[model samples]
Target chain A: MSVKIEASEGGRPHNEILGFGLIGSLVCIYLTYLNVLTGTEIFSFFGGLGAVIALAWGSDTIKHLCSYGLGTGVPSAGMIAFGSGVIAMLFATKFGIAAPVAALVIAALLGAVIGYVSDKVVSMNIPVMVISLIELAIVGALTMMGLAAMAGGSFMFADLVAGSTTVFGIEIASYGSSVIGGSVLAVIFILGSIAVQHPFNACLGPGEQQDRTLMLAAECGFLSMIGVAVISFAFIGFGSAVVALLVSIIGWAYTYMEYIKLSRRDAYDWLDAKPIHEPKGGA
Target chain B: MENLVLGIGITALAGALATVAGAAEDTESDIGSQGDPNSQVQLAPQMGYIHRIYNKAVSGEPPAYGLWCALGAGIAWALMSIQINAVLAIVLGSAIAVFVQGVYATTAYLGRTASLAKFEQPVYIDIIKSVTTVTMAHAFVAIFTTVAMCQLMIVALGHPFPLPLLALVWGIALGAAGSATGNPFYGKERQYQEQKFGAGVPISASGNIVRYAEAGQRSSLDNGWFASKLGGPASGICFGLIVFLELWRTVLFEQIGAGWGAIIAGVVLILVFMVIDRYIETWARKTYGPYVAETEEAAS
Candidate 1:
């Protein structure tokens, strides 16, 4: 039997990373609104970057929560975060320009309540459960909003739910269905869930390190950005979508290489495997 | 003023349905032996204690229910768009989702059991043929009730979210409630019955579950019957309260002070629960005390 030993006073505190992540991502995502308010899509990619930053923080929160021996709760926690985030986001976006701050506050309250229930009613008995869940809920909401902003060029409810499209040379009012009515929100939900959950699930073990896991988290975020960028063709112009796609690819490549380097540094040894041997005759 | 009364009515009806859905969801999972306890069940045969427990953990509770509820609600939404009767649409959609869940249950059980062939654990066709129907029945109740609740939110309460999205959100919440609140009762009290009550699972006893029944070998069917009594109800209350309180706060306080009232109510509710939780933890600790080593107890 192997015993899991957690450090009590080592590495960066989750709160510190959370502060940087929260402030940095909020600034980036809110700045992207300049494009929407100006009726331009130039700064849409900043929303994608904001999503990556928030997801990095979300990955750390997942790691901290699962470290408490949640058993099968790893996936549940991820789903719960997104589930609550979506509702809070839907509500917050109705406030027009205040969507970002509104989503942050709404998700925190929702997360706090859920965390309290998990600990008190369900008796999870973890000390940091409430705070960790609050961070996750907030991150989940922001990541979704960022991705939505990336895809639709705005986070406002009116823009997402009723934005028109230009077909051929004519501008089609409502375009039969808007970005959200066309089921882009569903796609965002699944993509955000996978991006937030896959990092720690892939890297967790006795040998797991925070930096490598966080790098992988960034890589996953960029990968999700690529998907969101591809889907943006349904909403934004081709030139803007292509720009987001290019930025996502560059970010993904950089982080992926950094993650690999960290993995090799922390690994005991690396071996290159040879091709499979053939048995002289083909089957 | 009329809207407030109508909202309260909708909230009450939705809360009741949520309770039923939550209970059925937990019971279905327990019957199938899904989630974390499933790891222990899988390890049983490898540890030289072969038994006939149904093992069908294809995924965790949240994602599974999310998929099921989303499909159900999506199909129903499509049918409703075509001017179909809402009740009939929900029933037909729920039926289709149950069929999908049945397929998953069968395949997961067969694949998991087949992999344990090296351990000499025989595949129980009888279980596959019988338990599949049982789980599907429970899943239908859960799916139908959840879909109905989403409909109520949309038609009665004027929730802005579309039907399928609402279903997805509540479905995930329901699965979380079941996984967190009800799973422990089935996993600890039923599977590891040999361990003393109120004492947590010891490290050494991992994967070593009680393999025998009172008269014959234990099976997941029996486990389900046991869990339905206590675990199912506990999960119901958990999810019910979550839905009730959330909707209740929004209905009463959302119009007050630019929605800060609802937010404040939520935070206040959380603080209250935190205090209650602190008391529960202390009481449980005082009652159970620390775990004593088995060897030391025997020696004494």
Candidate 2:
């Protein structure tokens, strides 16, 4: 008897796509409420959401998501919503209500510019970090100046300046702490990850095939860490330092555990399979 | 002492396993089959609970335990000696403790033979997956818990804790959280699926690149499964740690001279580690010989 399996050409079901949209919308609404309640404008949230959606809808961006199990339909939708939500909240807190929209615009433009420049640059990581750091510095300076101008010699301005400065001061201090904390934590994470991978590679040997796939997975793992850092910095300002350290550790741990679990499962499956006996017992 | 003994024991066990496995698989015909044989060691299908326990136990590896314990003790002393709130001291101390632990682990293992290279393909993948998960968990805990803890400390102590202390505490918390609750089941499902298909089965790829670029989807699908599972968590943890550390230090510690001191200390330590790692790698290469030389030596 012969069996046949049919392949489908269509994309993910409409319902799944719609489900992501619905989730995105709900998150948007909640974010909007939070911003308004905090006395921040709503435009920041909307603008952030718009930017995220645009990225999700773009072919290049969607391709990247698809590389990871995130389907274009639902996963993209969730990414749009989640990314926007987080970015919006971060901007609102850091730059105030009107700043999120501006930040989104700036970030998009910056991302494009950086993308172009990165193609020309030999070392992408350092340049990217530098660009991000510069952008952050500019935004911070501008925000402080703008707030000072708006508060123009009134008691309210005094309070605003005090509050803004206080926030900024707090942010600065936190960043310092994060650097201290993150340096150590990052080192540990790197060591742990290396340790795990080293023994694994040794056991697997050098000519086991699938080198390209493993390399890609490792690259993706590293990229994922960078992505987390980018998103966090774009949203939370200085607070992202601490977040970055935590995120790096988490990423490393998750990758390590998952790899172990999957390998073990494969081993079990192999054990259960019927062994074909060769006359010479050689492949 | 117990922790040190435990660390030594685990290291010995792992080292023994590696030597035995290596020796067994060293036969001439086993060259390309290393990947295949390594993939054949899965003893359990759904050992999620067992995996979790194993992860937890291993997380407190010697380096981590020693660093954290030392930092914790220091914080306790600082709290008692100064007019600092015990809570603030403890939290900050813990954060620093874990951060130190992480640094030690990274320094100790990088470019060293004490790594996962002895296991197999899936084991390597698991290490990455677990690290990502742990990093994310740590990030979340640091962000949420530190905020709450700092606020409480401020209230109880009638002022915010010192910036150095805060940084230390936050770092430890994030590290601990990452080590404890990060993903432990990253690549299991994909490995099972591949096993079910019985190695060498062609797999289809789906994504925007496939539709627009006319690229062969199969090529990209190799890392797809594992990468997909890991992307979010990895990104989350990375971003969280960077953002949190940057913000916390800038806001709370920059005014104080201690923050700069800490930064300098960190840089110096990293430099030292880098040198050590380089030396270790050089030693390994010189002692083991090149892959070709080793192979020839074994044959003779």
Runs in model 1 lying further than 4 Å from the true structure: A1-179, A182-283, B294-300
Candidate 2 Cα misplacement greater than 4 A, ranges: A1-97, A118-283, B1-288, B291-300
Worst 10 residues of 2 chain A by lDDT: A148-157
Docking class of 1: incorrect
RMSD of 2: 18.3
Worst 10 residues of 2 chain B by lDDT: B45-54
For residues B95-167, write the lDDT of model 1, one tens digit per residue: 8668657755754564445445545555566676778899999999999999999899988888888777888
Could you tell me the lDDT of residue B284 within candidate 2?
Answer: 91
lDDT of 2 by residue, B1-300 (tens): 563444334333433322221121111001111112212222111111011000111122122222233334334323322335665655555554444333322221221111222322122222333343343233223332333333333333233554324434543443333322222222233323433332222222111011111242221123223333453244334434433443333444434585685465456656876899899999999896554443565899
lDDT of 1 at A115: 89
Question: For residues A44-72, could you state the per-residue lDDT of candidate 1 as single tens digits?
Answer: 88889999999999988988888777645
Please name the candidate that would achieve the greatest DockQ relative to the true structure: 2
Model 2 C-alpha lDDT per residue in residues A1-283, reported as the tens digit of each score: 1122111123444335334533442243234335335653322223223222222222122222222332213222222322332333334334444443444454445444544453356343332333332232222222222211111111011222231112423533222122122222222222222222222222122222122213223322332233223222212334433444354456546544554343443332222112211122211
